[model samples]
Target: MKYPILCCISLLGSLTAFTSSATTCPEILSSKQRLLNSTENIELCEAFQGKTLLVVNTASQCGYTSQFEELEELYQTYKDKGFTVIGFPSNDFRQDRGSEEQSAKVCYLDYGVTFPMMARSSLTGSSANPVFTQIQSQAGVKPKWNFYKFLINKQGKVVATFPSSTSPVSSTLKNAIEQQL
Candidate 1:
C-alpha cells in the first residue's frame, strides 16, 4: 500500500511539472483552424509552438500554384530541424478552385504536398483570419496575391515576408530559414 501510494504521488508531481512547462498559445497563433478536407481543427500554437514556420497563403488556380512543389521540398529538407511549412488556401484573389474538395485535391494529390494545408479561408482585408490579421499587424503588410509567404521565428515573431514572385527555394528565403534554424 505504501509503495503504490508513493508511486501515485510521484506520477502526479511529474504531470504537474509537464503541464507547467508546456507552451502557451501566443496571441498570433491563438486561433483554431481546420485542416484541409478534414472535420478536425487544430489550435495553431499547440501544433507549431517552438517551431520555425513558413506560412503561405495559397490558391489552387494561381500562376504560382507550382510553388507548392518547391515549398514541399523545402519542408522535407529542414522539417527535422525544428522547421515547418504551413499552407493556407485562400480565394481572396479569386483564383481558388470551386470548392474545398477541389482545393484539397490540388494540395494533397496534384501537388503531393505533405505539409499542413489548412481549409480555404479569406486571406486579405477586414475579413482576414486571425492568423493573417496578426501577421499583417506585425509584418506591416498583407498578402497582395496568392503564394505570399511569411516566415515566423519560434518566438512567434514575423521575421520576413515574401511576395508571390519569390520562389520558396530562392536563396533569400532559404537563407532566412537557415538563419532562423
Candidate 2:
C-alpha cells in the first residue's frame, strides 16, 4: 500500500511539471513581425503575451495623421497597466511615402511615438500581413482606411474596433480599453 501511494504522488508531480512547462501561444499572436526600419524580427506572442493590445494601421500622409499624438497619449496612460499600442504603416490607400525610413521618421522623429511600429506592410487584400489577417478573421472586419484601430484583450481576442474617424481620445475608445484592462 505504501509503495502504491508513493508511485501515485510521483505521477502527480510529473503531470504538474508538464502542465506548467507547456505554455500555449494564442492564435492571434502566433506570428513573427519585423520592427520598423530594422532587420530584427520578434514573435508577437513572445513579446505581447498577456497584455492588452491596441493595433493600428497608420499612414503618414493621411488627413488623420495627427491622431498619432492622441494614440501616443493613450499608450502612455495605460501602458503601466499591461496595455500597449502597436502601429503598422500601410500604403493600401496610397497615403504612405513608400519607404521604411520615411515611415520610421514619421513615427519616431515627427510624432515621437514610442510604441512598436512594424515595417511597411499591406493591410488589405491577399497580401495582408499575417497579423492583420488574423485580426480580420477574428474581428470580422478589415481596416477600410489608415489609423483604423483594433483593441485586443489580454487573451488575444479582439474586443473592439475603431474606425479611422474615431479619435484615440474619444470616450468610447477609452472605455473599451479600460474594460479590457
Candidate 3:
C-alpha cells in the first residue's frame, strides 16, 4: 500500500518529537500507535485483537534467520489457539534495509515468513522505536540482536522478552507463549 507523504511525515514527526530518553518508548506508541503492518499499513494493534502475539525484531541476513522456519512452525501449531508471530523487519543492526516489498518477497521466499511484517526501522538504543521502547520498559533487557522476541499476551500487555538466540521451536518459548493462552 502506498502511504501519503503526509502519513509518512507524521509518523516520523511523532517519533522524532518523542523526548529522547532511556525510558520513553512506551509513551510514543501509546500516543501514535497506529498499525505499521505491511497489509495496507493497517493499525498493528487493531488488526490483531483477542490474540497472543510473538513480536520479533527480524532481519533477512542474520544467523538466527533460520528461526523463521521454526517461527512458522510455531505459528501453525498454536495459531488456532489465538497465537501469532508478528515480524518487524529492522535495520537497527545494519543487517536488513531491503524495501518492504522486497522484505515481503524474501521473507516468504527465503524464510517462509507467513505472519504479519512491519515496515523497516530501528529497534533499540537512543534511536529506538516506540514499540520497542514499550517492550523494553516492560521486558527489562533489550534485544541483543535480530530475531529477539517479545511475547505479548491476549490483553495487549508485554509478558516476556527473549534473546535473539532463543530458538522459535524451543519448548521454553512455546511454554511461555502457551501459558497465557
TM-score on alpha carbons, each prediction: 0.88, 0.88, 0.75
lDDT of 3 at 146: 92
Per-residue C-alpha lDDT of model 2 across residues 91-147, encoded as one tens digit per residue: 889999767898788888999999999889997678889889889899899999999
**Runs of candidate 2 exceeding 4 Å displacement:** 1-23
Candidates 2 and 3 compared: the better one by lDDT is 2
User: lDDT by residue for model 1 over 11-58, one digit each (tens)?
Assistant: 999999878656455678888999988999998888998899999999
lDDT: worst 10-residue window of model 1: 18-27
Which residue pairs overlap in candidate 2's backbone? none
How far residue 30's Cα lies from its native spot in candidate 1, in Å, is 0.8
Off by over 4 Å in 1: 1-23
lDDT of each: 0.92, 0.91, 0.75
Top lDDT model: 1
Clashing residue pairs in candidate 1, if any?
A: none
TM-score of 1: 0.88
Candidate 1 residue-wise lDDT at 88: 93
